[model samples]
Target: MKTPETLLLNQEQIKSLITMKEVVEIVDRTSKDLGVGKTINPTKVLLDLGETAAYPPYSGFMNAMPAYIGWEDSAGIKWAGGFLGERKALGFPYITAMILLIDPKLGFFRAAMDGAYITNMRTGAQTASALKYLVNKKKIKLGLYGAGMQGHTQTEAISVLFDIDELRVYDVNRQASEKFAQDMKDVVKGKIIIADKPEDAAQGDVIVCVTQSKDKFLKNEWIKPGTVVFPMGSYQECDDEFILSADKIIVDCIGQVLHRGALRGLVEEKKLSEKNITCTIGEMAAGLKEERIQKNERILCLPIGTGAMDVAVATAVYNKAVEKSIGVKFAFV
Candidate 1:
């Protein structure tokens, strides 16, 4: 098959092409497919992502996660992660990533789209889908950790799906936290507060953690018995206590989480047992598991993050860009 024109869609174009509803729908279906046992290989792409005083000015790396769909997707689209930066960087994003949809027949590349916005939306959308399956929509007091892109993205989706009236947020950088509060206040028309500590925000009806801190954000005591905790921040964001305390635990993929995700810390320390974990967010989202159980059940949702999400979101962007002719077309034979 001849390769079609390679469209280059920038961030703005991609942004206009998608809406929260579409993303939500994609997430719902993707989660269900995942729950039904779809195989997606999401390879960990890492480059020394840490600010170093040494050579290369700012020594860092951009991790690229490439994922290929198997069984569920006959399109053979492979999505990858885009991140550029190192830890403790002054003003550089840790990851500068993108996704490439390929034609499996001849290994032809279909499209290359902006990844920063793509990554944030997919991750946030995944979390929201988890909330749909794990949290009580009636109770919507949300506490968010880290006022970064991921923080706002998650909040944006949450505001639409749940009747979230108030969001309590905190960040090491006071400005980032304050900015997030103000910006989200503008976007959601909901109540917003700046938190002094992670614990202060813990009591929210739905607490979403989005920081990149290595240290644990919330204590087990901080986690309410019946609250929904969505940890979207650190790779190992939650403390053992909070992780272990949840009546039900959900991951995007146990294989992914066990390797380098929010649950790795607990899994490594032996604080959380394998039996304590119930299902992946996709599995729960897929309807394989009943959505939001008894009010008192402790539900913790950790979107292990998957390639299917990237492919789904990217596909959305690609179709939109094509429809609007927003992207540049490239021809490479």
Candidate 2:
């Protein structure tokens, strides 16, 4: 019985489509099933914009990802493609994306969504999940660098699993830093202090660098011992010393890392081998391995971005939406 599926939900209906709780559950379940791995082929495709000033240098790029996700009992190929880079200059956004959900059985179009939040939160929450296991359970402060796209919600995601005493925020864009601090104070329920320099913010129990800097804005010396640093914004910024110095290099999926994530740069630089990666965060969460070996140490957690997570969140949201008939059913399939 291959009946046409004509369910079409608009942004208004899907705006509150995903939640933090759903995102965490996706991380937990995905960890249980896949054990933190994905098949990723990374590449850069150029674009042609028939306009002047060229708002964004790149547009219409695609990342091909085919994944075997366990918890969902579904295998999928979710494509991350769009004209995102140019959106920012048009006063829109930096990343504009859509998640294609397939019906593992029939190979039908189940749903497509604005994956902006899905991409941001899942990656951020994966870092938070690593922190939940890696960071010492001491009530300490947090420092966030480049408090934009991925930084703001990361604060909230970390708060869900741990208690943060205070937050220090820094960004080259002063307004972003100030706004992030104010918002964090209200939401994180902790004191928010703005940092004057990158070094100032790095001095914390946990330091998260979520910037767009191509260079190493965060110096290795600035990293304190036993600090959990998440330099998720750019690749290779942490450098050889930082990689070698980190007692533990935890990642969401080593496959993605090696393919083209944080660890790829380390490997290209000959700083790390396959064995150098301490372990996937899933192993620690699942009790297959341990985290934070000693009190005086530093660890790095990086999640490149996984479709299994996107599917996990989309599944949860879809289920809830179906329960209440929240989405609109269409006649055209």
Candidate 3:
């Protein structure tokens, strides 16, 4: 037998092979597969790389996220790293990583590709998938925090779903928010307003927080009735009360949510648990569980990112790359 070849793809190659609309559809399909138990997706495993001789104090961390999707016959692990302090100085994004795809049947490494583009696009697409099943409104006012890459993609993905009358953008760095508004001016059909305060961004029909802050900045009272809040960060961007007091709470994975993100602290405090979770977003999308029983019900969506999502999207990108004869392929022992 000949040695198997593994494909190597860069960020630019992957970027050329996928789009947000395609990713949203892929996420929708993958969520259903996940919901019906056709996938194996575990909670993220974290590695805290604390201060080292060469790195600064409280330097950075990495997460190992692995999963398998039976329907697509895809398997992979995403090694996601976050080194904001060092990366900023190096002029790199805070989070950077790669995805490794395996031949599920043979258990051979098949491909290694840039994951940052996939991460940003899929994160936004995941939110869009959740909104597809959770929201009923045709138009909305969106309040967004963390005017960064995530903020830009979230708006892009959401703009595909509803008519936005206004997009309220907020960031602790005033320049970032202003830049976001200016950058998105032509892309976003709705008027973009840079909010002076986090609270100012909170008063909206749909609220999304994607900041890097570990501190709880979003107040519970700022959230209105009949709103859906998507907290897309790894830590508590919103107050614990915001999650505990919501009418419904859905996540990418119950185990993952409990282990990290907005729900972790609450779980540790015994204020929340698996029982408090209404269902996975996959369940809602798959129609296995009901969503949005009442318009006035406040819903919280915590999607910390999933390997299943990565595998599914990555698989698509890989297939496209192969069909179009993109990327470099070479044997590795």
Candidate number achieving the greatest lDDT relative to the actual structure:
3
Q: Please report, as a residue range, the 10-residue window in candidate 2 with the lowest summed lDDT.
A: 44-53
Candidates in order, TM-scores: namely 0.86, 0.87, 0.96
Q: Number of clashing pairs, model 2? A: 1
Candidate 2 structure quality by residue, lDDT tens digits, 78-138: 4554443556557775555566566777776666656666767777778767776776584
TM-score computed on alpha carbons, candidate 1: 0.86
Considering summed lDDT, which 10 consecutive residues are worst modelled in model 1? 74-83
What is the C-alpha local distance difference test score of candidate 3?
Answer: 0.87
Sequence-dependent TM-score of model 3: 0.96
> lDDT by residue for model 1 over 89-192, one digit each (tens)?
45656445677877656667778877777778877778777777666565478888888888888888876677677778888898998888777776655678
Residue 230 displacement in candidate 3 (angstroms): 1.2
